[model samples]
Target: MHSLPESKKNHLWRKLVWHTDTDLHPLGPFHLAEVYCCDESNGYAIWYVRRLAKDDARGVAGVENADYLLQYFSKNHRDAAIERAVMLANADPSADKVIAALDRLAGGAQKVSADR
Candidate 1:
């Protein structure tokens, strides 16, 4: 539940920037999710941001909004974590499902570490 530093949040906001007018832009406005990952001391932190608007005028100011979901996984699970993030980002925006899936992944990571 700890928040990311302001510098890291700014970097993530930059990565999430997208223009609806661009052809490369993905479909859907509010349901669209942007995935960002950063290496942390304990593990890799994956952040999912579900856009609430097409324009998303809130910009960097909304980086720490409650709508953001942050999940951490051991470095050994980095690939899996990234894959899950991409899958969730492309899938429908179901908060419950996303949380459950992340919890499962985090559980697996913890179990692996415990086994070690």
Candidate 2:
């Protein structure tokens, strides 16, 4: 449940606005993910630990690069970028397991009661 510090979030938001001309919220919390500037481009990359399931015991981590100025400049770019970031965050080596888990969740997996 870790979150970026306010200063860091502001920095990221500034960069996004400067590059994309879109004033959008910064990335939300993902316990095993981090966002940073890419050394090779004027863009940001996300490094994340990929898990096959929400409660998976182990994870495979890697970095995914996306160009904000180039790949995310459209009107709907914010939503698209967020979706891509989420997909990258959830990426796993066991693709089938990930797909199955996603399918189950999309098809209405059981929900836990908040009071539990």
Candidate 3:
């Protein structure tokens, strides 16, 4: 959880803290899905990615501007949620497959948009 380097840690933390800041980026270990630590607006709001669909891309925010499934306030509690997200992404084979399918759907969207 806390094993990330200071630089990456700072960036990850800020991605949650500074939500509106365009410069702050999301950390993506899995394709099309991302994990945000916390944000300044909401205290330690962590999100988890479950299964994603092509249209699940709605309400996208953050630097990656992707979708997330669960978001809750943690009242200064940190790292645990991020750790959970990482663990969930790694441990859940079904979620991984869903992400892959979503990725392909997203790719098709890009191609359609390009053709337009």
Report the number of the highest-TM-score candidate.
Answer: 1
Ranking by lDDT: 1, 3, 2
User: How do the residues 1-116 of candidate 3 rate in per-residue lDDT, one tens digit apiece?
Assistant: 44976534432432211122234434522223544454434544434322223334432321123344344446465666566545534543554453444344343232111111
On residues 43-78, what C-alpha lDDT tens digit does candidate 1 reach at each position?
A: 766665444343443333223223343567796987
Clashing pairs in 3: 16-38, 16-39, 17-39, 17-40
Model 2: colliding residue pairs: none
Better of 1 and 2 by lDDT: 1
lDDT scores in order: 0.47, 0.32, 0.39
State, as a TM-score between 0 and 1, how close model 3 is to the true structure: 0.35
Ranking by TM-score: 1, 3, 2
TM-score of each: 0.40, 0.26, 0.35
The candidate 1 region of ten consecutive residues with least summed lDDT is 107-116
- Model 1 scores a TM of 0.40
Candidate 2, superposed: residue stretches over 4 Å from native? 1-4, 10-75, 93-116
Candidates in order: C-alpha RMSD to true structure? 12.3, 15.6, 12.1
lDDT of 2 by residue, 1-116 (tens): 99976545522222111121123525532222222222123334322222122443432222122111212323334444455545632555454444333333323323222111
